[model samples]
Target chain A: MMSAKQADRLATAGLYAVAGVILALLAGLLGYVFVKGFPMLSWQFITSPPQIFKGGGGVGPQLFNSFYLLVLTLVFSLPVALGAGIYLAEYAKDNWLTRSIRISVEVLSSLPSIVVGLFGFLFFVIYMGWGFSIISGALALSVFNLPLLVRVVEQSIQSVPRTQREAGWALGFSKWETITNIVLPAALPGLITGIILAAGRVFGEAAALIYTAGMSTPALDFTDWNPLSPVSPLNPFRPAETMAVHIWKINGEGIMPDASAISDGAAALLILSILLFNLSARFVGRFVFKKMSAS
Target chain B: MQTVAVPSRVLSSQTHVTALTGPELTRPKLETDRLSVFYGDHQAVSDVCLTFKKNTVTALIGPSGCGKSTFLRALNRMNDSIEGCRMAGEIRYDGIELQSRQVNVLEVRKQIGMVFQRPVPFAKSIYKNVAYGPIRHGVKKKKELDRIVEDSLRKAALWDEVKDFLHQSALRLSGGQQQRLCIARALAMQPDVLLLDEPASALDPVSTAKIEELIGQLKKEITIIIVTHNMQQARRISDETAYFYMGRMVEHGPTEQIFSNPRSEQTRQYISGQIG
Candidate 1:
């Protein structure tokens, strides 16, 4: 019922208001993180192990542990996720079974991360009796990552043109051969992007690792590399501490004087790791996928 | 019209004057005994029986929704991929039943390749797109694959235009080039029967002429079946023509007869520009 000029003015003001709020929120978060955490970033704070009273305890061990978990989770989850995705997208017919499985996957992807952590704790820690070790943590992270990986890979494979599949078939190739040679290669870029994003999620996870990997730091033992041994050096059965868990523990106990410092260091490291993963994913897509498509 | 001097044998005939018939035809390389296609409850094609002679171009001409493309797709079992689409009756290629459940659809597709109405080149390099099938079927040697890629491109009449940029992405090509690349991809399998579903309907006039010329040359090496709505194209490129109306083949014979002396009233009206 307003005049045309008045209504137009109101609409423009509403659009600007929404944009302003979003920008303000983003800027505020970045400013707070930088101002609170930048002062604690130092060589000693990065390299030294944790101490009960010292303000600048190093995070070297925690950083190493995070890397270990990230690599192991990716190694275990990538193949299985890609395989399941290819099967669902390329081989499976659109029947009741496939439809149900697809719906289940969509549901799993949206479930809370904390819930996934709880399941990991039950299955890998208590049931398997692995205790607080890197193995248990990796298994937990793998479970959390599997559904996401599958969904991404499935979508990428499905995005490929039907004609490409038909072209392969016309060349006398079987379904398996066509998927392996044609479909998978074409979908690699999107698959890698999903893996990188999943890795970021795993690197930042803390709640799930709490019950599975524990907060206790172990002494370095290079000779205990035997994977079969229950107390092996690399075994997740031994208590392991990651950066996110360390931050949580230090902050909760209120014992460490530089709790803010530790949190800042952990947040920065997490951000850096995610950034690196995304950059590398982009690099791979640009060079490798481009070459593959043109080769 | 002026009547020429009749031969002595025709003059000696007592009963009536007989029109001259076309040349005798050979056995068909691919034949359908009684093909019927259904999409769930609705029937798409009904009791279509036809034969395609070896190394000859056959055209299935029809109006929209007349099931010409459906029949063409059935030749390669491409229709099998569609949900709720079912086919009854027998389609045989070289005396081998293509519709039997036991028969491998993959093998049938390999022997009888298909080109769709639209150009569909994979998002891969021109060379790789051409080499994709050869490699999957256990062609391990790189040198052999390279040779096959070149040969197929040459056969598709796209070799000279694409030879220098073999490593370029297939998507970077023009529409006409992309369609030709699709043809090359199909020919790489060395299929005996080539099924084209309005291959040139999506291209420009120049591109259409190029495809028509390619079809003429391909008949020397493979049996060709084309579905087209263009009657002039049917008369120009096809040796035999089948006019489909309302999911049924109203008339089928030599191209000259189907165009000039159709046997059925429906076909006569259709070809004379009186009805669809």
Candidate 2:
């Protein structure tokens, strides 16, 4: 029995309240990160490797390792994720087998990151005997990312109009060709967004990497650059320390004396990297989606 | 609605004669013999027999749910994509049984294309949209693709409007131009049969006229089967017309005969704007 004005006021109030809360939370987190860590963010702190029992610790090696791992994880996950998504969205009939796979993916998506870490530890670390390697950790992270990528990509593919598929077929294109030429390109934005989000999740991950990728920092060695060579510096099987692990190691074990400052610096750097990644992804997405919609 | 009963002797004898004659009538580009389609257990089209002569326009006219669209889709085996939908009897193209197990749906589609009620341009540049089919069938040379795109667009009569913006997205075109772009995309594949399921249904008057004109011109090059609710359109563009009622072919013959002197009372009522 509320009046029209009253109902409108109530709806407006509810929306404003929700927006306020979201804005407040984001502002609070950003403010805290900047305030606590800005003082310690020096050139040397950014460029130099962490030294044990020292006041000043930089994340130079950790930053490099994060990028390397991100690239490797994308390489492993992109093709498989996109391929599985295409099959599910375009080829797979809505039969019992497809239904089961969909259910399994839903289950995997909901499973906690820590559970994935535990599984990685059991399989990659203990069973496979790939003790504390970057490759192993990347593989584990790729598994974590796979289900997400598939769901996002499948949804994107589904969002593409059936008319487009019909148009392609009408043009005498095969199913595979139609998918590649018409459907995939149209769904590219959603696919890229999924990948970027997965990359962010992988970049920020600590618990899983701690188990699979070991906590030992490596010295820069240009000569041993082969990624697959067991003895090479780039070999993922070689123990590598990332930023998240560096922060955890510093704060928990007190390997670095001024743990508070170093942890804050690492946290700020992690936040910055994630923000940068997301911003770039958004920029690319805007361009691609605009072009797609225009076409 | 007036119901004139046809003697069973004529019906039975014609069916028997067609069955015995085999493929002697120099199989038209597309032919459907006693073709019926079912959705689950419910029949959508029943005992519909028709033939589309090569390089001629054949129109299927009916009220809503009479299965004209369903029959058009059956020609290209597009109905196979629908769940719980099945077809009975035979559809032959150039003396080959289309429903045979060995018939590749993809290859069949390559020869027989479709244009839907609404224009469905791919979310790609004008150039890419036309080039998509050609590229897929192993036309790798960019120059060749460019030539095909131009030729197809020209054939579709869209080249004059969109030639300068070939790189622009297809979606930016006006409705009529987009429909023409879709026609060009189909023409690029050089399909022998073009099935249009109310190609002008969603268009404005001008666009509809353009599409109707395109259909008239296209019939000279490829066999066309169109389903339309618009009687004027059927009369204007079709060489042959098949009128359907309650899933049955009421009458089918030369367009002039069906429109001017339909033997069936159902077709007469339908054309005179009485009972649907």
Candidate 3:
């Protein structure tokens, strides 16, 4: 039998080995993808629209669609999520009904994205007759994102110190004013962090958007600033395939000469954008934390 | 002017007895008629009848969980924010029933400001923290707000230290400074009555002394009600002190009487540190 010190040493060594393996696996995956994909990420490859069966085209429209869809989903989800969160954290009673609502949010959040996509396809696309448009996709994405945003907002609001609330009440602010001005500002770091993380997740979403936003990108004119035009990218009714869906589509069905190269470039761009999002989120969180606690 | 005629040496005689319990010319500024507070099934304060006179500081001193803080919160209806917390009995401010149906809680709170135990300055600039109350009440002009902020901070004894950094976030201040900033924020409302919930308990000796000094000076302007655990602080800063035991007011009179002359056995035991 080994001595106690030897056993402790063995345990520490084992832990380090496990950590090393996990780190190496993540680094290897990212390194492998970037090494293969970065070369194909050219200016020309990013600025022009995708070429069908031929060769070199860009991802401008799909990129725009991804950002637009992300913005639209956030616009719909943020308010509902924040309001529900505030109600849950600040106003909800400890009752059966409140518990049921909380449990439902948890259940909805844990549901598979594909399942939500199917529901969106059934309800919005077929029954609602939206017919695979940006709005349908945004609605499904919002549904997918609502539970997460609500949880974040609820936790953030809950984390604000009780003394702060009492101070506001003591200063004669109404309940709503206290919530909007004091509670919201104090919870800013967490709220902004949650929003950025959700944006990242929404940016990479494909399974749901493919069903609601459609896999085919319609013909578009970038200069058509009129929102009602069929070809305007801003039109919510138009089919808008995002970059993640574009990658999935190209990977599965492309027969072009440079299909592999296009996928490589798009994959690199996707990972790079996510990294940027995470970095910026960290920066904003730190900035807000400093502002709040510096005194 | 009525009180100034009495010599300090003669206050110990029978002349002071009626001065404390008798009818006053100003109706005691604020009065609580058999006020009681209950949290769910637990009764924290039971029938606490007391009066706070204008231009005088009264300290509520008791052991932990004796409902002193609860009693103070009741004066401004601060306990209303706590769910399942109920209060019975009338709280009158300037002859108007504060607990009445027609009374607006927000309006009552605006007139009666509070400073909490732990400092709770808003996570904003020093100027903003002090100016928030006045601005929210529709003092929109920048010049007016600047004046209020400076005047409030000056009253709290903080303007001299933070004069240059008025626009800086309040979070950067020291613990003592933050507490003073909270006092300044309350002062900006120009409240007629100020309630302090162990306002100096969280501070060091020096900061405590500074706050005690400010409180002494402030009693000349507004009716001040403070809750504190420190017996010495109670004696040093207030004109009258009420000793609470469990959920009841054990004894209340002039600070000198409560500290020196024993009325109730419980009050005597508590003052002597026999029972907490």
Candidate 4:
């Protein structure tokens, strides 16, 4: 049999090898994407609209649509997810109903985004008559977003030590008061990290948006800032195409002469934005945790 | 080893029971009758009846899992927060039954605060930690909160060390200082009773001595109930001592009587380190 020291060394080397393989894979993927797409990126390429039969097209509306859809998705999802999470973490008893709810959330979170897209298409797009619009895309995204958010919130709240709650109760604070003041503040870091990560997912989403938000953008008047105006970019009822959807569309059936170039630039921009989101999430989470915990 | 003789105010068995229950003229500050605490089906504390007089310290000494901590927690209804935990007993404060539905638990907790074995200071500034209790109770004025914070910290014997940087996070303080901050947090509510569960066990010797000193000073106004594993701790700080064994109070009397002249065989064995 191998000696304990030999076993330890072997285990350490094996772990390092596995870690190195993962790191190399990630680096390789990122490098390939950046190398192919970075050359196509330019100010004009980003700001101009897509061409039907021409060479020079920008992703300005699609980029705006990505962020707008993300904001709208959060607006639809965060409150309901937060409430459900708090209930599951703090108040729910170990009963059948709560157990089933937990199981359902788990199953729902594991479901494919495409399935959620179809459901949103059927329910929000056609049934609710919010056809091919940002609103429908947002509602569909919420279906995909809610379970993950609820789990994040529940785990974050549970991460707080039991002693903290006891301290609150010892001070004669009500249950709601304790949860709001002590628990939420302590869980803020995790909540912020979870939210921004979800935002990144929503920002990069294409499949759900294709079915619900439509594959084309309506002509938007740049000066028309009114949300109620049909021609306004801010109008939720208007068809909006996100950057990811644009990339997918151009690659699949584009008539533009520079479709491949535009796709490469959009893909690069999308990856960069997601990377930015992840980095910011880490920075903000750490900053808030430090500020709140003072350690 | 030089040992000094401590004068024993040891009372007879009859007189000791009478003393614990209190005389008609001096009503007990708090009393628990047939207090049995259970976590689900497991009984942790069984039929513990005790009386606490005002302006005095009573220490519950026992081995691990002897229900000393459970009994202490039950006084403030802290056990209510634990899942599957329940209590069957009457806890009276100032002649009012606290266990009754008529009594508001929040008000009881306000009047009776507890300090835990490990200090639990909120992840906030020292000043904010102390002011949190009073703010919830409607002491919202800036000046009043400031005054209350200072007064509570002073009472907890933490003001001298933390006064200069009260705005600093309580988490940054030493373990001893954080414990004191927790005490100060509870004291801000101006509670009549203070429950301490091994408040110094997690601290160093010097911090423990500071906590013991603080406890001695605090008993002048607050009815303090402490659960300690250290027999010496119970001897040094408490006016009354109750020895618990296997979820039962084996004996209780003046600290001197219980220590030097115990009535029960188990109490004597436990005291002598022969059995725990």
TM-score of each: 0.88, 0.90, 0.93, 0.93
- How many clashes in candidate 3? 3
Candidate 3 Cα errors over 4 Å, as ranges = A1-11, A281-295, B1-24
Residue A258 deviation, candidate 3, in Å? 1.4
Which candidate leads in DockQ? 1
For residues B1-276, write the lDDT of model 4, one tens digit per residue. 222221211111112121233344576888889999999999999999898988999999988999999999999898888889999978877655677665678888988999999999898888899998998988889999999999999998999998998877888999999999999999999999999999999999999999999999999989999999898999999999999988888898999999999999999999999877
Task: Tell me the fnat of candidate 2.
Answer: 0.54
- Per-residue lDDT of A1-295 in model 2, one digit per residue for the tens? 9999999999999999999999999999988987898887888887787777767768877877787788888899888888888899888998999999999888988878778878888898889998877878888888888899889889899989998887776665667877887788878777778788888988988887888887876675646777787556578777777888888887788666788888888889888888999999889887886676554
lDDT of 2 at A45: 82
What level of docking quality does candidate 1 show? acceptable
Global lDDT of model 2 = 0.83
User: How far is each candidate from the true structure, as Cα RMSD in Å?
Assistant: 9.0, 6.5, 6.3, 7.2
Decoy 3 TM-score against native: 0.93
Task: State how far residue A118 of model 4 sits from its true place (Å).
Answer: 1.3
lDDT of each: 0.81, 0.83, 0.88, 0.88
Give model 1's DockQ, 2 decimals. 0.46
In candidate 3 chain B, what residue range of length 10 has the lowest lDDT sum? B9-18
**Model 3 reproduces what portion of true contacts?**
0.67
Worst 10 residues of 4 chain A by lDDT: A286-295
What is the clash count of model 1?
Answer: 4
